[model samples]
Target: MFDISMAEWSQNAPARARLLLVGGLVALTGVLALVFSLREPGSIAIAEWWPAASAAVAAALCARKHERPYVAVGVVLLVFLGLLSGGRSLELSFLDSVGNAVEAWLVAAIIAARRQQLSLKTVADVGRLLVATVAGAAVAALCVATGAHLVGLDFAASFVPIAAAHALTIVCIVPLVIIPRLHFRVSTPPKTIAISGALVLSVLAAFYPGSPAPLTFLPVPILAWAALSQSMFTAVFQLIGVLGGISALTIFGGGPFAYVTGAVPGIAFLQLYSFTLAALALLIGAAAQERRVIERERLALASLVRGAFERGPNGFAVLQEAASNWFELIEINAAAPALVPDSFEHSAGQWRLQRASRLHEIISRLSAGTEQTFEWSAAPGAASTAQLTITVGHQPNGSRTVVLAITDLAPMREAQRKLEEQLARERAISNELRKLNQQKDDFVASVSHELRTPITSILGYAEDMRENHGVTADEESLEVIERNAMRLLAVVDDVLLISRRNSDTSEPPARRRIAVGRAIDQCVSDLGRFAASKSVEVHVKVAPDTYLYVPESDFARVLSNLVTNAIKFSVPGATVKITADTKGDEVMLEVEDSGRGISREDRDRIFDPFYRSPQAIRDGIPGTGLGLPISRDLVHSMGGSIGLKSVLGEGTCVEVRIPLVRPEATQ
Candidate 1:
């Protein structure tokens, strides 16, 4: 009933515009008729044809233009009135003029004398204006009737039909001609009943002297009241109005006197009609309102119920609370039913049952109540059996509901178990490798110790024989023995250091603040002959006051390695420069040699344990592979970082950075 479909443009807007134009033209025509009457040519008393013609023309125009053609027809009625005074040849009678003026006056008075202000733009809103117009016409007729009576003219019931005829003309014209045009936002139905009742009352009111029937419009003011109460839907309520106006008229209506004046002349019908229309509008509006609310609430509940049931991902079912043993199934959304595997529900009465999916088993987990769940298991030959978790919520209607959520955990759980096993295996292998490494270190240390004893004894005997027998111990022979012994000692030392670090039981190296300048000076002093033999100048740059707290022996070993490397790599005429200084909280030592330097690949892994460069091996550089590793270890024991930078065939630089913790005295 509350349909918005009527809002289509073909239905109401064009009609409203036509009605607005028609009403304006009709009123204009009426005024023109009056003006013609007042003009020359027998002072308009003879211009009877023009008045009628003008009305006819205006009505035709309004009929085409308006949805309701009453306003245009009213203009025509005013023009037609000229017939009474003999076509205005003589001065038109003042009585007829007064009656016409009063009709117009009353319509304006209803608008102006309104107790509440209104902005009438909708069909329901304009319906009240139609009522007022009819009632005003009635008042004019009643007044004419009363004035005739006071002058001793006999009044007749015949006046009633004339008023009705006039009113009917308005209704027919307005509906046929106007309502399809002037555009408004709201849709409004044609006002047939309201106009009819008002027209009947208007003719009844206007002709009688001092007629109260004009007051029929008193009820129409209630339209203003609905301004707030029925804003958008006011048109619907206006289409439907208070029905029993004729009955009310008959009850209080007895004669022309009773009819022309109000039904309860002074206080009765006026108040009753107004309150009744208002109360009735409120009542009918409330009914429409109530129906709308109920529809909305019902739709909402239905949607919520559907969402809960249909959107479930897993299997679900219902069972009767009364019969627990004979479980019968009713409806299911799942592919498989797991709960009622061995059982089915009774197909009778209000209590019904349903099934669960392949992975589910109905487990009675409810303690006191008759609620339960089903566990899901893997079904064979399926991609994977859906594992399920189920819960039941009790319905107030005494139906038990089961909800199942299926989850597959096979792949995830298996992967996690494998990861744990892998970790265990790795720990076992690490333990075995550690034991083997310790044994290897011990064996190397033992062999080196025994070999060193024999070599030392041989060397001492050879030295004695060379001195006593006056045999020449040539430089090459002496150098060979010395270099071999040193190489063996280096290998022995590397093995011992690795084993000690692995056990973590070795004593930490002694630490003391030693001046950076003094340490570099001592290394250069010791390496002077070595550098001199290679014809490589060893230059020293020392920051005199610089110092670092590190083991003196470890520092000496580190510096000795750097100088020996520089001398070994330097070209005969080139220089090897050693520099030392304090930088922030650390002391930096650098050794740079100008010669064919280490290659990129060798430079990267140069300090790796037992690593020897291809160039050094090919050149028969006599040294153990432990020199760089041992130097790095000694430097690290004193908390320092050892680094190298080199370019092929250009030069190499070795740097040791140590924390500077100056002591009160230095060795």
Candidate 2:
């Protein structure tokens, strides 16, 4: 099935116009042939018979190469058909129609093949088109000379005129049709009207009667103006108009070429005139078009670069190198003025007078083609120490410029000053704290010493009274006094030891290897009476051969304090477990009591000096609240750690880990 839509699109306005142009050209050729035959008396002939056909084919071919072959063939066939139908009774033969089609095809093919070469921008391009026209016309003239010979006409005479005529026709017509289609440009209506008027007036003046023979050259200047002021399309159209005017004048024996006596030579001279004018118009017009395109591109690129330079955040400046290694400021963007106060000066001068010596060295390096970047500080007497990052860039023309980025360092300097003041205040407060701490240690040592002498006397007297006398009515009272006196002495000793530990001049504890099992056994034995008074069961689990690298007296005190606290807190019949075990490189001792445990709120403060749990105070447990804290200090001095874990109403556990002694090292 045929698609009617295809036919519809092919017959659109542009397509229809092309068809009309081709058909009209073919009809015009036939009509001009008949008219020329009447002008020549006795024989019917065609003047430049195939010019319109050649132009139609060339126009179609130049539209676009991919469609050229199809368009050229279609137009050529249509023109041939039109010629045959119109010239049936005009002495036009079938061979003539065939020859015209062949000539059109030859010219179109040569032009299409060398289309790029015929850009008319250079003299070479115009020369190539002229050569192609002459070659194609020579081939077609052979057919015309053969036909003239068969008809017994002058073949030699007819060949030159026919060839020249065909060449001239194509030079004037093809560019008019093809250049306009290829390089179409929209021109102002007023400009088009003005150019058209000028063209008409020039053609009339060049060909009008009684004008000098050299006056025909006047149209050459008009054609040159059209090529320069208008597009290639407009220029080619004006050339065709001038050609028409010259041809009409020559045929009437009115123009310079028409003054020749013989018809063929006169027509040949006319053809040459038209060919020369057409070449000039086409070549100049093409060069003008190329120049316009280049100028437009240059302007667009300049605009783009200027916009980028203006909107950039960083300052930019260009300097031109001058005599004696000096520089002249050529250009600077908007941001450059704020960076350098006198940046807008056009004269050559040393703009770096305000810059530092270091900045001058950087500029010297840049002039030697070495790029450099460094921080610069402004000279004194400026508002502030302007810290600037200066970068030096070198150009290819031995010129250099320095770009400065200023940073205000005043806020940073202010913050640093405040920090220094804060540090000084803290140092003063720290010294005062040290002095107070020293005084406090001295007071504690003095008080413990003062209280210790009396406590020792009282303890000695109480021991003597209990040991020398027999059981009496006041025996229990004596026992009570002795027990409390010993406790008070232990408290005093703890205070003295803690004070010594805090003092700078205090001596370190003397470390010795002692059996861990024996130490724990002695602690349990020492706390046996206290456990009996409370009716608490003391359980001892000591790992045999376990030893500790610590002071014997200090270890004994730590064990005694833990065991005493465990027995005091435990209820009657509750077990107080004292376990000593070796764990890796450490000896761990635990004092666990199944007693009223510490509350969560009091656990953190359990080892603090003079701090006791609420349960101990409520139960009237006799304690100075110094046992655990003193034990912690002693353990830490021996390079050990002490910790407590307790659950309310469940039990309390105290664990102490001390570094174990190697028997071999001790030996």
Candidate 3:
């Protein structure tokens, strides 16, 4: 025996399942055919009405397109065997089986062509099934009639019964099998039991012995009730029970259907009644199920909206617009009561009084259906305010409604106030620092001015003594005093220059077109003694025609400072070179020195005032750290830039670029 749950069968489930289904369908079709077939010779047209027809169509529909060929062959062979066993001749049985198989395949093909699912859940689904059933039944009936005519039976007399029987069978049986395949929540037991009891009672009353002929319609209401109030499954199940009861009672010659004059007419009437009940139950059940689904979705959406409205932080109010230009409060969410504590009527009256002008504007523009925002105080003249944003919309009946949302502005205003206070404090601190810096610059200027006169007097007296008392033993001491005095004067001059630059009262010196080569020569000459003392050679390379548009004094100061710095940092016998030339619209001046070069770390702030390098401090180099700053300031005041490039332990180069004076303009 094969284990069906084995991996092989599981993997081949589709192919295996279809094979099993085909085999089962063959067995079911054959059994239903034999059980329901009529043995009367004149009842050949009723072959399509057999239970085998329903089973054949249902199996064809259940089979996929690729599996239908095998299913179709099985249906034909099964129906033929069943017909033969029921005493039909071989030729007629084969033809009738062909018609039945064609009918089943036609129904399946029509549904597939329409791309409809097999389940009936909506009115449209019922309509699609109805259409497919009618079409398949008519075609099958014509085919059966033709086969009967070929066998010398009357086609016109046979087509109607064949068509009616096939259509009724499909309508009655297909949904019974198809609808139960869909999973549905079972109807509540109370309603299910109540409707079930009602249907059973109705069927028993209509089909009981000696019942009147019109009493057969009694079960219609019960079927309709089940359709409207019960699940689709319950409704369809009740329909099947009613059908079964009527057929069974009539077959026993006991029901209202059995009272009809002729057996054939009674069965026809029975089939008509059954078809009506099936249509009623299936159509109404499908519509009711669709309505339930829509209602369920609507209720879920309403709950979600209610949750958002109640839990939201913003205060919300719904108001109806009135003819008197006043809003009538209609509803409020959970947050609105906090913002509007007083009775809404009283608050609304106050709003109309206090905000009359804006209210008039709002009323005038509300018909345009735009959102407007305004500031509102809870009470008149209150400090804290809330922002009200109102959106206007029309209701379904053409009445206008306004949705107003309130957001408190007090916290935002408080944050803005604190930010302003912090900024004010920062501005005040910055202004005070500026004032103190100005005072310090003034003090330096005052002291440098005071020291310059004495330094000049000492230098003059010392020089006079050296000239007058020549060959004296103290001549070298006189020279030392003069040199020290000159150094003191230079420091005082640098301090005064810095003070003037920092003071707002001091204006830049008037610009003069000065020759770059002459300026370079003057700087080198001024530093000649300093460079000679260190045994550093000063080399000058400049294009004599390279002139700059700058203050003569500022230019002289800049070149002198750069050369002085270069000389001071130079190694003994290492050359200090000053070069200048005009490039593009500017004059470039570079002072290169073979010195213990500034390190990468110190190079960034080499021109900052009073910022001495770590290397210079470590080596005990004598510098007030003012030369480079003063140079930078003077160069900037002349609208130029200064930069330095250096490699530690290699030579350092200080480059300056100043706007060059054209020769024609200078002349």
When sorted by lDDT, best at the front, the candidate numbers are 3, 2, 1
Residue pairs with clashing backbones, model 3: none
**Structural RMSD, model 1:** 16.9
Q: Write the per-residue lDDT of candidate 1 for residues 144-223, one digit (tens) a residue.
A: 44444444544443234323333333322222222222222222233434443444454345323445434544334434
lDDT by candidate, in order shown: 0.53, 0.68, 0.76
> Which of the numbered candidates is closest to the native, going by highest lDDT?
3
Displacement of the residue 321 alpha carbon in candidate 1, Å: 8.1
Error of 1 at 474 (Å): 5.4
Full-model lDDT, candidate 3: 0.76
List model 2 lDDT by residue over 162-266, tens digit each.
777777777766654444232335367788788878878877777776567557777888778878887766677777777887777666656676676655566
The TM-score that candidate 1 achieves is 0.41
lDDT of model 3, residue 613: 92
Model 3 CA lDDT for position 341:
45
- The collision pairs in model 2 are none
Q: What TM-score goes with each of the models?
A: 0.41, 0.47, 0.55
lDDT for predicted candidate 1 compared with the true structure: 0.53
Clash count of each predicted structure: 68, 0, 0
